[model samples]
Target: MARPNSSPKASISPQKKNSSSPREADFDIQQELSRLQEVIYESFHIPVSRWTIIDEDKVLEQLEFIGTKIPEAIRKALQVLEQKQEILANAEAYAQRIIQQAQEEAAEILDESGIIQQAQHEANQIRQQVQSECEAIQAQTMAEIEQQRQMANGEVEQIYRKSVSEAQQIQEGADEYADAVLTRLEQELGEMLGVVRNGRQQLYNHSAQRQTNNSGKQLSEG
Candidate 1:
């Protein structure tokens, strides 16, 4: 009997399970609601007393527990709603920025169009002024030649030839001036068109860049 001592068995305690997380708590609430609904539907009806017999105390306890969790659940829901609102706000802001940029670009294009119109108007005015001056000079020269012819009938042929030569010179000068002004106007118009084209190209490039950036952002988010 004394030869072998009995080995003592070690007692093991059960580990306490971890409490439910907020997500689990929410799931529990849903389950409880469903169960409460079912219990209500299955409750015994007392026709005589017109009263339903169910586990009132148990239902009240469950309801009390659910009530305690309601504020936390509502708070979480509100947080989600706020996050969605923030995303919507950001999208709206981006849209506004795009609209503003488009408006600015349109304004710039309109300004360029206005400048071109003004240049053309000025060119036309210059042409009209030049034509008027040429006409006035021709008329004055003709008048002077008529006066000289009447004053010296003896030198009529010589005076006629000189007047014709002066008229030809005046005509050539007017033609050369008109040609120079037209050429200058053409060059200016070409330069202005080139500037407008360059501006449009730059705007297109900027828009493409913004689209690329937006696509990259969406891909990253996905």
Candidate 2:
């Protein structure tokens, strides 16, 4: 047997039943308007700075829909904003760090400069001291050399005088020896002359005696 048209036993689809509900239809329309208002506020900071849940059930439905299917451009815009904030923060921190490092390096350079200046001063003092000592040694050596030369000159003068005196004495002794030899030779010549004269006188006397004896013999014989 076919069911009557007026029978209440006929079943409807779940989708159709939901569409027919007045409460559900009103909730869907109101949710769409709330979501539109939310978008406007986010874009322009309009209506107020504080967030308000004007239509709770409606806003909840729209938020759920956005979570599942948001437009690509909106998502991209939000990501760019977040990236820009992070970049600014990093730039600030890096600038502060660079400034601190520069300050430290400057301090170190100043300290090193002071140390170099001190070393230069000390080195200059030492050089001056060494120069003074060298000059003093040179002067002392020159003085000592002069003294030695003076002493040597005095000794040479004394030796020269002594040699002159000794030479004069030796010359006088040689002259006296020459005079003594001449006197002895003159005495020897006088003795030799006397002996020759005596020999001539003897020869004459013998001749005279021979002649007298010959004359006497001749007379007697006659």
- The root-mean-square deviation over C-alpha atoms between each candidate and the true structure, in angstroms, is 44.3, 61.7
Q: For all candidates, what are the clash counts?
A: 0, 0
Residue 128 of candidate 1: its Cα lDDT?
A: 56
Pairs that collide, model 2: none
| Per-residue lDDT over 82-195 for candidate 1, one digit per residue giving the tens place of the 0 to 100 score | 343233334334434443453454456646454445444544554455455545655664565456546444542344335445545655654565555446545654665566
Predicted structure 1: lDDT: 0.51
* Top candidate (lDDT): 1
For all predicted structures, in order, the TM-scores are 0.37, 0.25
Indicate which candidate wins on TM-score.
1
- lDDT of model 1 at position 108: 60
- What candidate 1 gets wrong by more than 4 Å, as runs, is 1-155
Question: So what's the TM-score on candidate 2?
Answer: 0.25
